[model samples]
Target: MFTHFEPALMKFLRDLQNNNNRDWFNDHKQQYEDNVRTPALAFIEQMDQWIRLISPHYEASPKKVGGSLMRVYRDVRFSKDKSPYKTNVGIQFRHEVGKDVHAPGFYVHIAPDEIFLAVGTWHPDRDSLAAIRDHIVIKPGPYLDAVEHQPFTEFYEMAGNKLTRPPKGYDKEHQLIEEIKRKDFIAICPLNENDLYQPDFCKMVASRFGRAQPLQKFICEALGLRF
Candidate 1:
């Protein structure tokens, strides 16, 4: 059974609300480990069970992906929006190894920020990033809709600093031909921290999550708070 969050743990996160900079990030490593990382570890462990129950066909991804804290920088002189910090945490679901950027599914921004789960459209591919390109261009509707409804305040005090847009040049091929994609990503705040726990919305989203791919009941069952 899952335990309720400790008071001390929440207080620690509250303290990080106004904190910033690499020094602050590094200085709080121990607290991060004790309160945040440890809890996140427990979360993933439980999530593994959910994955197996939801998509049995899925071969479990590595247990160690994002197993450690991440650096808050992207060394991209070749591109734009070069920030000094990574605004999100990410975990990949790839069938193959070796930086599987083309493979589908990655969780994002689960620590020190919005704990949103992304189901598609991120590429770490260097040579040929066609699949990722397609995700951003072809099926951008569903993910974009989810992004609009994101509520960062629930997770991060400094969520205002996070990425507001899908990275530059997200649509190179230009195939996002839908009203949903055309709609300005709204970025609505969550009605409640427990919004994810709403049975109606949760069931609706989980049911048609990937269109044609109705999610297993186990997935819907595991996504919300188990009462």
Candidate 2:
């Protein structure tokens, strides 16, 4: 059953941030499961049901590993930092059709001083990016209307990396040129620490996501899929 996240969850994450080495995590593995993974799984299970009501396209994987619960271990192979573990908890509700992160998805991030909900396509493949851009050029009104909707605008702001100049084949003077330049199309809503501590946090998150459904559906439709 879903209740409230224990204060120790935050404490454990904070401690992990300071002592990111594997040795420290190895010693605290059980605590990690009890405080972090367990509750996170419960949250995902509950969110799974809630999100289905919004749209059957999204999924919340409940597996203890290789599922919606992102691995605490960081892939430091390519990066210079080489930290052994991630400081935050990441939960993604990906579209059923998406093979990986390249496709449209909804994300939840939890960490010390950083908690938010996001939805959109992040780092889409070349073809997918081109398709999204073309959709923006052809039917900008729906995209604009979705983001500008009062329910969505009340919480999220349009966020993503963008090209400094307009992309080729698109006019700089186009009304939606700003959106066409975006590489990652996303909307984020900040969540306070107290928000996570609430017993009704799951419901609150679901309601917020429902409010953002128009935006989610907009992206899905742009990609020629259903939400």
Candidate 3:
């Protein structure tokens, strides 16, 4: 039974932002477990049931490591900012066949600055990108139905990078050219902290996810995968 994220989660993350070093994190490790990791794992565990209602193909694994919950450690190998810890909680419900974040998924981002729920693919590979574009061109009606529908547009706004010009082999004059020009197909819904603190948070998330289904289904079809 999932309820709400403890308020302390945000406070811990804000504190981490100011002190993003290994020593500080090690000292505050118990706080991280209580306010962040444990609740996150519980959320993921409970969310699996709701997610299955959306699509059995998606998973919300509750494993402490290598599961839906993203790591708190920062990958600073190539980054200029060498801060060793992340300041946000990231949870992703990805498709069974999906390999990475690029796969069509539902993403939850929790941070002190902002909270948002995102759906669709981010930075898809060359072949997947081409396939989605081709599918959109071949079946514009369903694509439009997915994105332009009241349920989808009322909650989510289209996001992600777009090509400056028409993508190669796609006609600039085409009706769905703008959508086809996208390098990433993602939609985001901004959220308030209060929303996460609500006791019915899981229900709210599932409802919004239902609104995103048309787009998710289309993406799955484009990729020749089950939704």
Candidate 4:
């Protein structure tokens, strides 16, 4: 029984962008829970069921802490701009064995100007990266077909940084060299703010992810895992 996202969710995010401090967040914690957090958790709960229907190998945790809901707190210890909170809501449905963003996963990013639905591995460890590149080298047809599929290509384009030169062991002139040289294998479909206002937004998003299943499955197989 999911409903449209509360309009206040966007308002809260806008406010957070302006006032990215703990004091401001503490003052508006209730709004965060009622307008943003609670609805987001409900969406995640429903998404968990929807995702399982597509593939039992993937999971969406509804927990407030370590679940799919990314923490609002920004890790500014290493960064120069020390904004205390993120101004967007991020939800990820990832492989059960995946520990972080590195694992093959699907993502929903909700923001004022940069909303999108994405899938793929981001910054994988050395071993995982090698596995993916090796797989692309051996059998690139499926990967090519998946990314170039009209339905998928209509919405998403290949994303993330790529190496200028071919990686070690990969041919510089290989047909799939560009894809194999990618540091992250991700695709994103930009979204409109109005899209979140639909009552069937959850199902709509799930369908988009479904269309990308071939790519997800391929990435999983390359990593020696189920999709």
Candidate 5:
């Protein structure tokens, strides 16, 4: 299924690592599409099915969630620091765009070396903040046991925006000014270079997605392997 993804995913990671810039990323936009964008969507499509089983209080006819790269340019007019880009995947769980209270979902960071996913009570149509607040407040375990058995493990919080972790206290160690806005997280198990997409690992991940039934089904169907 990810036949079109392997090549581009490989190249984009290589390019992004050395000289990261808007122009650099834009130049290889198509590569990003072939690898990251396309495959991410394909993956998220499977993810949505899982979300359905887990979050029943969702919009019945919701829009397909999407994954996108956060812009590198930070609007300095409001603040001073200008990070060219964020190195994590940010997804919105909604039917469409144009709203701040998008869907609830998670991200996977290629750097600081982490992989995982999570969701809160975010439903664009009904309760956006409520969903997020609930998830963050309860402190749901980011890494499920099944997912932990995979090749990668979800690690400590990535960019402060993913979700709220233990309070930073007065140290102000985190980068983001507004942290509470983020409300969920996920981390994968460890993996070796030669051990990607292993059937056992994939099956374990599929099993952990118990709440996300639709998504689990999609994965099962994709590999012709069932949980």
Candidate 6:
């Protein structure tokens, strides 16, 4: 019974971008709840069912706090631009074993003029990075198939930071040396606003995730995690 998100979600975020202060957000909190949070939670709830079928190890939580829907509040403690709230809506259906954003997961970013779906680990720990590189060396075909073949290739493009030179152990002449130089194992697909307006939005997401399963499974195998 899941449907499309209303246009208000983007409208609210755009407005928030202009008036990013706490007072402005507080005044419009009800609108946020009604148009953004509520719809987002509903989407997550439906995705909870869809993700189980896609991968039992993953979760699409609908909790008000500490769930798939990321917090609206921004942690500006370390940065100079102390904006109290984030202008974008982020939803991550992370692996059950993952404790933080660095874990392997499907990420959805919704914002005005910037919308995309991403998958895999972002900024993984040193050990995890090494393991992924090792896997790429040992099993290059699957990696190639996942990226070069249909379904996955049709949707996503390899993204994330890359090392200018090959890593310590990997040889520069190696076929996948470029891939091995990656600091992140992330892939992303750009999405349009009309896509979100479709009634079968959840189904479309599930389909895309299924297409990316081979890549996810390979990463999980490398990390000794179930996909």
TM-score of each: 0.45, 0.97, 0.98, 0.98, 0.46, 0.98
lDDT of 3 by residue, 1-227 (tens): 77889899999999999998999999999999999999999999989999999999999999998889999988899999999998999999999998778889999999999899999999999999999999999999999999999999999999999999998898999999999999999999999999989998988998898899999999999999998
Cα lDDT of model 1 by residue, 12-105, tens digit: 5555555545577688778766765565455445445445443544333435444322333555687785444444434433222224433333
Worst 10 residues of 4 by lDDT: 1-10
Find the 10 residues in a row with the least total lDDT in model 1: 179-188
Number of the candidate with higher lDDT, 3 or 5 = 3
Query: TM-score: which candidate is best?
Result: 3
- Over 92-124, each residue of candidate 6 has an lDDT whose tens digit, in order, gives 999999988999999999999799999999999
lDDT of 5 by residue, 1-227 (tens): 32112434544665676756778878977876666656656654555554455443322222223133333244566666454655544443422222342333332233324444432223333244343334333332332332233322232222323434433331234333233343322222233322224434333333443434333222222223333
Question: Candidate 1 vs candidate 2: which has greater lDDT?
Answer: 2
lDDT of 6: 0.92
lDDT of each: 0.38, 0.88, 0.94, 0.90, 0.39, 0.92
The TM-score, computed over Cα atoms with residue i paired to residue i, of candidate 4 is 0.98
Best by lDDT: 3
lDDT of 2 by residue, 1-227 (tens): 88668889999999999999989999999999999999999999989888899899899988987778888889988999999999998999889897776668888899987999988888887788888888878888888888898989999988878999998888899999998899888889999888989989988998888888887887888788987
- Error (Å) of candidate 6 at residue 35 is 0.9
What is model 6's C-alpha RMSD? 0.9
Instruction: Score residue 19 of candidate 6 by CA lDDT.
Output: 99
Q: lDDT for model 5, on a 0 to 1 scale?
A: 0.39
> Which stretches in model 1 have alpha-carbon errors above 4 Å?
1-17, 57-89, 94-102, 106-108, 111-115, 124-192, 195-227
For each candidate, how many residue pairs have backbone atoms clashing (under 3 Å)?
2, 0, 0, 0, 20, 0
